[model samples]
Each structure stands twice: as structure tokens, then as C-alpha cells.
Target: MPLSEIKIDDEVFVSEGTVGVGAVRQVTPRELTIYIEGYGDIAIGPDHIASAHDGKVVVKPETLPGAIQAHLEHVHDGEYRRPSDT
Candidate 1:
């Protein structure tokens, strides 16, 4: 989905690469502003987020230190989910 479709109270994985549930404070062409519970209001560029639906976003488990790194290395190999052409 396009970032324009995201709304308040949406849980998103931000470009900072941290997953958090943030309440949408505002949305503009250049940015999406949200107030995350512990992080306070943070404005992120619209290009820096991907939505997570009901915990369905897949991230390789990071219990081991190298796992997240390995996952990062391969994250761009394919489109995990492609937005529809709508």
C-alpha cells in the first residue's frame, strides 16, 4: 500500500529499522509524522516505512547477533511484498 493509505494507530516498521506502534499525528507529501509510545513524536520521510498487518511482517529472528546482519544483507534480493498497481 502507498504510505498515503496508512492511518493513525498503525504499527509500522520505520526506516530507522525499529518496529513500533505509532499513532499518526500528521501526513504530508514529504513526511509521515507519528507519535510512538516511547519515542515521542517523530517525523519520518514518507519513503522510510513499511506497514505491518496484525504481526504478519516477516523479519528473520534476531536471537543470534549475525542473524539481523545476514537478513539485512539479503533484504533487497527480492520484493517481500509488492504493492498492487492500484
Candidate 2:
């Protein structure tokens, strides 16, 4: 998704990366900040984001340094997110 489109509380995903999911905490012109359990908050730049689909931002794990460990958060797969959900 476009950086402009991302917002606080939005969900994030990983593509062949460490953190499987993240909760968006902040979005700025430069990057998107997401919080992962046991990992804390992380800022993701556009280059690492693979794509935007189904209202989620998919990021590449390799792009995230020091994110070697792996874990997954609840995604509620296929659950449609409403505008108010953001």
C-alpha cells in the first residue's frame, strides 16, 4: 500500500521475513512504524514493502535488520477490514 494510504492501527505482514505480522503504530512521509510482540516497534520503509492487498502491507523480512527470530500474530485471514477499523 502507498505510504500515504497507511494509517495507525493498520495491520502489516511479512514476506519471507522474521516478524510475521505487525500492528501499525505510526505512518509518516518517510516510513511506516509497526509494533510486533517481543520485537517492539519497527519502522518500515517503502523499499521493503512488497505489496498492498486486502488492506495489509506486506514487508520483506530481509529488509528488516536484526529481525532474525520468527513469530506470527493473529491475521484474521480473509476478514474484510472496514474503514472504521483503521
Candidate 3:
């Protein structure tokens, strides 16, 4: 997809072993800079990401205040699930 088509609250697979949803903060022809809820803003190559949305509501973005707690919840809950294979 074109960079103009991407948006905030979109999940993207940056690479194998590097998949984190990004909250779009800025955009450019060659990059889509995003403020990953827990990781802060980082500029990722447009070609390096695979958009993870399929026009379905699988996951939703959280508000800023809820971001921390949600991350904690995911982490806490992760202890019980099998690790993902990159």
C-alpha cells in the first residue's frame, strides 16, 4: 500500500522477531514514523513493515493513559502462553 494509505493504530510486522503495532505520529514518502505505545517514537522504513490489518477488528489501540496498563496486562498474561516463533 502507499504510505498515504497507512494510519495510526495500525499493527505492522517490521521483520521477523520484530512485530509491534504502531501509533502513527508522522509520515513521509520513505518512512512512517510512529510512536509505538510502549517503545516511543521511531522511524521505520516503509518497505520494512507489513501492514497487519485486514479491515477487521482483531485488535484496537488503547488511549495514552491505558497504554501502560494494557502492556502490563499483556506481559502478565503472556507468562501462560507459549512463546511465538519468529
Candidate lDDT scores, in order, read 0.49, 0.67, 0.49
Deviating ranges (above 4 Å) for candidate 1:
13-20, 52-86
Every model's TM-score: 0.42, 0.65, 0.43
lDDT of 1 by residue, 4-69 (tens): 566555554433355444456776767667664444665765344544355322222242236333
Q: Of models 1 and 3, which has the larger TM-score? A: 3
lDDT of residue 10 for candidate 2: 64
TM accuracy, model 3 = 0.43
Query: Which structure is stronger by TM-score: 1 or 2?
Result: 2
Q: Count the clashes in each prediction.
A: 0, 1, 0
Span of ten consecutive residues with least summed lDDT in model 1: 55-64
- Which pairs clash in model 3? none
Give the 10-residue window scoring lowest on summed lDDT in candidate 3.
55-64
lDDT of 2 by residue, 1-86 (tens): 46887768766777533334667898899898888655678777889788755557777766667532344334444447568854
Which run of 10 residues does model 2 get worst, by summed lDDT? 67-76
Predicted candidate 1: what Cα RMSD to the true structure? 12.5
Question: Model 1 TM-score?
Answer: 0.42
